[model samples]
Target: MTNSRPVVNKPEIDFSDPDWKRHFQEDFDKQFSLPHLRDILAIKPRPTTFSLKSRIPLDDGDGAATGSWNGYVNDDDRALLKVIKFASPTSAGAECIDPDCSWVEQWVHRAGPRKQIYFEPREVKAGIVTCGGLCPGLNDVIRQIVLTLEKYGVKNIVGIPYGYRGFSDEGLSEVPLSRKVVQNINLAGGSFLGVSRGGPSTSDIVDNIQAKRIDMLFVLGGDGTHAGALAIHNECRTRKLKVSVVCVPKTIDNDILLMDKTFGFDTAVEEAQRVINSAYVEARSAYHGIGLVKLMGRSSGFIAMHASLSSGQIDICLIPEVPFNLEGPNGVLQHLEHLIKTKGNAVVCVAEGAGQDYLHKSNTTDASGNVVLSDIGVHIQQQVHVH
Candidate 1:
């Protein structure tokens, strides 16, 4: 029998206790384990001469080529993505209570080329699709995947048009892909394969995959799109299909937990900053003027916060994470009154999803099923005019 319970749930063990190592290992092995295709397909992995084992390292600043690089990430090569709750998040001084578990610290795998691969490159048919709203660096990501597959000697590469719809829609067809076809795609915005919202059923998509004999599927999308991808993968797995599904998370909001940032976040922040700066100029030019700029951040406030920080001219920043009032004594209106009286003008930056309570909540959703947010910017403007 094994103690499969999380280490945090059990009584705290003394630091001097010799059994700490054994106890920690039990939780890590069972609770934080990652899955592998080798076990799923029950197939032995083959040694990969990925890019012929001679790919150039990113650090080679002098444009020097590497000879037979040995940079294949392995199972032992893991990282700490999910940090256990050693202490309450607010206790700044509290971190890693059980520091003695040194061996358990070497967890999670780094992203890179693996020394062993499951699929045969020449015979592999790779399919790529982009779903959800457009974001920065999508084309770059697509181009990179295509080039990497080409380097691995995969000749039959195809792009799925207009997201999951491509598989079911008769008008949408698979676009043949190659190195030459994707060569300057990175210079452009949006995806070469195009993007769309909620499309055909996962079962139908899998049917197409089986029909087309797609060996590997690469999905690029936001959180909702990622869930759809996982559902598709699970369906394929249940059918015992020999297909590998890979996803590259791309959210302009950068809301994914335990992950650093998402693609296009920087671009979103930079564009928001520019808008805030413009608002600042307009506010300062008028007498008792108010400049209001709204940024994109439906749930998270990374875009609004970062843009406000980057643009020094913003006097107030409203984010979705923080609830604010407009009419009370301590509300935004009162604050604006003070700023107008003292400073004569002020620039306020807000997230699109901020202060939703002040507006109507409709059950309506978008093409991707995301709730269409009420216009907080317009609401704020109207409130200011009324006051």
Candidate 2:
């Protein structure tokens, strides 16, 4: 009767038990309310309409209704038209009409017909110059330009060698193009027309154009090349000469302002994905190892983003748009260490321009006025080694 204390029983705990771990995870999930794959994949449907008046009128032999524009829309072109029609409109009072706007929805031939060349087909001397860096599908553009001009009945087409300099360089050569010369050129990569850096004065370029009697000039390059083309066009206009200037933007960087997607971008991303896969394999093969991959993206991180998303093998991705740290509790190095300690391996995909702020800057510029970037990949590798 004096010892009336209540008897108590203690609960036993086992850390190594699989059922204990599973129960712990279940409790954690219940407390945190983690998201499910089904929730992420569940996207709501939005209303869309594809109905539109046919842009291309029935082709009449005379072709008077269409003016200089050829009215032909393929299935792909029709699909693009629907996308343009459904896309968000530009802000009010915008100066330039959006390329995707309904007003510019008509699918016309890339080569011109709203404007006519001042010369006849045989007398029309056309010059094609490829400036800037290499890009995929350039040969295709060249071949198409040649064939289209041929369709327009132009026989004198010349390839300006080594970019805009071909216009003024005395020793630089020019290649005469024919249907046979460019027949199978598109089978290869790089520009068959060749490319170079820098250009001559605008007046000198205009003089060369006049000397060659080139009625049409097609400039294939990035913004820099387009600037040169604009200068040449202005000079020709000042001299009261009628020369049609066409620009086909080319850049593997894919940083153009208004363009949706540039040529060579898909190929670049595909190649990058292969590298990411290789990194993943290497990381998985080593114990507590980390594999890092660097991709091409000087000003924009499109390549890195696309590669990481496509491969689905990357543990972490760093881009220029998002700033990251190398030290501190929430830094990349800490995160990598945590990942390796927990999962035994980690993979990182970084863009070339991801960590510019962490490095010393250099006052270097390329021929196209692009600033030379520091090697972010090497810096990251060194930092990883130190940590």
Candidate 3:
């Protein structure tokens, strides 16, 4: 089978053309744009009561909003794209895109509290669901959402237990939520509402939303869960139902696009550093020893890369972004041998999703429809033993 890289035949235009700027700006805006309520329904917004800036101790929850809350983000506010373009020998972005390599200012809609909200705070019944696997800051995220909604004067807020399963599960029920209820929930790790994988169909979920009379829904999860939220949004729109679906993305893998970083990424990297240190100690203690640390990164290698960089003890770090071979004159096995001969010991860190191309492909998937990854860590360990 051929593993040749597919050629991207980009339609070329003169870089000096004055219209290129306009074209680029339009394309960029289209890519990062979010749909507003006006796009679907012509609902007039109500002034938000999220003006709580002065209360030093947040639980005081009394009296009128200070209104002096310096700024409320307007719909037109945009955040400049902060991440640098990562180019390599194969991906020479600057050389290919422009001879000057200068980029036009890239902006995305800034996230924060808005002065006017589409839903009437008191009349709105909000539902929150945390889906997929647990992450480090799920409870904190839930607590913040509840607190923010309370600040907006929302009276009816409920948690959908165990991800989307609560939507159609025969026995599951919604848990009433409030600022007081979720005040200390952040002290705990994992999701306060718990989480599950795949659940009932989107149609079934929307049906439950209608039955529960939920006007606003906050969905927290990774890619698959976000896809489900999008489906729910479309289903609600198709039925001409007045429902707003907001997704607060969550994942430890740091795989989300157009985002600087996700909530759980820093924590994951910090935890992985400790593990790498342990591996280093273990390897250093033995003669010609090798310590292999396998980390979790289902899609991206942020944890493995950051942890290795932070620990400074890892001799080699393997990630999905860069390719490596297990066997050859210039393969990983050769490098390990070189390290053993020179350094007497080595510490290697690998991301779980790395080196999947070498494995036999599987059609099996987990409950969330995520592909069941072959154990690359165990394979590397076995190869090390044999070598």
Candidate 4:
């Protein structure tokens, strides 16, 4: 008599507990073993002895050297272009036989073509050094550049240890890179080479670039970093060095006008939107509420406005460029009440530097002593008594 029910092995498994060691091992294995199609096509053999010179031997009518050698065997330089082949030394003569000669024509034809392609594989070494503040896609860009340059027959590209600071402090070292040097770095956050917070001036950066023989320099940072890059470009021009300089915009502020979007802005906006949505949900649950989400935007309304618009939970958005008045008939309090009386829940996004107080009291100041404004989200929320 057997029971038809299947027996289960109930082993005690604590899935709730964080197994960091297992997680790390799994991630490490996945990262190292990952396959890429680009790596296969990039593997090309480097030349061994590329400096061998192929000189053409000439035949004189009376065994006298003519042409550019001009009756001199040691002149060895050829002005007239001719192709010749080496023949086995005869006991009677010490001369290289010309291929046109029939006696050794068979041997010359077997020696292959006279035009030789010299494969002088000079190992190209490059490095990426970043300075001042962290940008979102610096590491990703570094990875792409290294991979792309390798495909361009560059064998030795390195990471400048630290930023410009390391060149002065720890000195410089050639960072050996393979596919392994920048593996899984595209998904990485922050600079993998690590950046310096110190903004090196023009002269110091140029000196470092020249001292290191840096062929190309990629500078990733905000306005100050961009200014530093510009200074470096100017200095390089003044010195007549062929240092190719480029700048990658890496600010979360989204204030750089030349670039459509900086790397960190998307991340910043995403985080702000998430927080605003969460706050809206919490405020909605309270049922008698209005929420004021103060977001970071010192000079631009991009972050505050984008977050508010994306969430669709915020009814009002106040930016730095647009002035907000909390005392008027269509004031901050009036907006909050309007949303609440109609929708029962109100969310407002306010830029941290949104111009004056909502009640129009004090004034804000930027680094350049320009008048900025206080965030109006909190002021409106306070007036509405949002719990």
Candidate 5:
């Protein structure tokens, strides 16, 4: 008897084989032929082209399109989706004016050549610290600067604690930054670094920056902070330390010069309006005649003036820049009387900076360690009620 052994021949398997294309094509066709995918692929691409006039057409009785349609034909059907897709990262899919919604066309007409970035990305080595009072968009400006710098392989960032106090002749209290640390910080209120009334006028601050060897310093604060950075810059330039100082203006007082619209001013205005509006309502109800509301501002009348303008109910506004004098017949007293007699009701907006020219000053200090503003509103209110 002869023992029979089964013959086994290995089936050839070659990933790089020429016939692999056919096999892969067959598998792809079969896998992608699922009912759901078939339905999606079956949809005829939507039309995106539209025509519009250079100007809006005048409305005649009949609603027929009639005008020099300005030859404004959108030839690029893919432009809208491309723009929308580009903006989606920042806008998060909010409605935008993109002409093309087709992903295929967008891919074809993309702005730049597609390539993978392979260089080991480096950090920004930049740091921002807040000082004094907190402000709005402090986090936003910090985040934007970080993000922009990050794209250029500079991502190393730190937040100096408690403003410049965090950085002193001793050293910088550093918080290492990464994509994870500052993510989604834009449009946030207050400062991520947290602010304090520390390091107002300290030479040790500049010494701290030098000791830490901070590549770039972004100071998120007000005039004092700006002055601190400026002083440091001057010293650095004088001694050649190569430290770069940039300032992001922020304050509730809005007194800082050069920059327009600091962070907290918007919030301050909204808050002041609420207070003024409520006071006006109460004045009307109590028949207290009028409420002379005092809003915050040391050197700037921005807050008080804005409150009156925004609160339409407030009949008159008084700012520090425009002094209130009662010695003459054409004084503020006469002005309020005129408004009361004509408007039936009056809500006056007065800046805290507007001192009492006729009355005595008070001995008080606010939370910021500044002298408290005298309440001219009370003096005016008293005199008006007496008369």
Candidate 6:
């Protein structure tokens, strides 16, 4: 009778032996020293048609030829508005602290040129650094910055790799960014230079800026990143370094104070809508089944609200802005049970920061100094399963 067991092959040599290590090192050294190997690993720099000396005139009179709205602002009254000064209110919901305060509606206009020309075109050496979480249009924004700088005849542009940490890194390596390199980067998502949480000291960043001779620094991130940038700018000012720091707000939650919307918010909502649709289908297929979909939102409910509205199939929506009970008569669980009884199924959408009151808060924080949020989604899942 033939043997039915499978035959196994054994190695002739043991890789754990010191002889194997020596042999591997010898082979590696020999292969790496070859000229053909070095040539294969070398990266070629991208070519560009534009030169630093080439100037693209801002006022080329193309707006008049194209019948565009370029010089329309010149026709308006040019007066600068005075900054608004607010006094502290004694009570909440009061507009002013003084009871006898008089309201005045003064619309101050610009008295001089609205746009101030700061940096010269060709002399500008721009640096871009992206920090924090991934956003959809990061690459698009990077591409636009590079293209705009190139248009202004600014040839020296470098992208700092891996957030503020790049400033204090041992080698302090930065990628050379130009119109040619960033032309097709917008076709992809996320940042090409990469991103990370936490940052180096403000002095370190300022030192790197001074060392690199970067006149313009563009920081792309949310609130935490902006705060760091502000510190860096202050340090630069203290040192009398001539550097212009600009921030581009990037948050998928759309929680930035003055901004109406963020770049990735719409994309996030659109993607969440698809997940809600799938969850709704699953819920409808079973008797009295409940489908729960959780979205990204820390302190705000913008993503949850927009996703729920766009989905239209969500029976219950919960967010961090509002607190909801889980066990009361009017609680979420009770409401979901009632809905299941009436409609035979239920679908719920929740933000990640929702129902924080129900979970145990951990005394921990992330690298960005944000308090670690409990997983409300898993908590809700466990509660639902138990009920």
Q: Is candidate 1 or candidate 4 better by TM-score?
A: 1
Model 2: runs farther than 4 Å from truth?
1-119
Model 1 poorest ten-residue lDDT run: 56-65
Please write out the lDDT profile of model 5 over residues 1-387, one tens digit for every residue.
011111122144234565644654455346433222123233332221121221222122122223543332322222222333333423444332222211211111122111221122252257788777766667777777675555434556788877766765245468876567788776566677777764534456666666676767888777666666778766666665545676777778777643346777887899999999988887677543777788887767888878778888787677777766764687766777786677656787878677556657767864345566666767677777776
| Model 4, C-alpha of 249: deviation from truth (Å) | 1.7
Among all candidates shown, the one with the greatest lDDT: 3
Position 347, candidate 5: lDDT:
81
- By TM-score, is 2 or 6 better? 6
Which TM-score value belongs to model 5?
0.61
lDDT of each: 0.80, 0.72, 0.83, 0.59, 0.60, 0.74
lDDT of 3 by residue, 89-144 (tens): 25543322444444556678988877666776778899999999989999899998
RMSD of each: 6.3, 20.6, 4.7, 28.0, 26.9, 22.5
- Residue ranges of candidate 6 with Cα displaced over 4 Å: 1-55, 58-115
Clashes of each: 3, 1, 0, 2, 11, 7
Taking all chains together, each candidate's TM-score versus the true structure is 0.85, 0.71, 0.89, 0.58, 0.61, 0.74
Which stretches in model 5 have alpha-carbon errors above 4 Å?
Answer: 1-124, 169-172, 186-188, 198-202, 356-387
Of the two candidates 2 and 4, the one with more favorable TM-score, higher being better, is 2
lDDT of 3: 0.83
Q: At residue 94, what lDDT does model 3 achieve?
A: 32
How would the candidate models be sorted by lDDT, starting from the highest?
3, 1, 6, 2, 5, 4
Q: What residue pairs are clashing in model 2? A: 68-113
| lDDT at 82, model 4 | 21
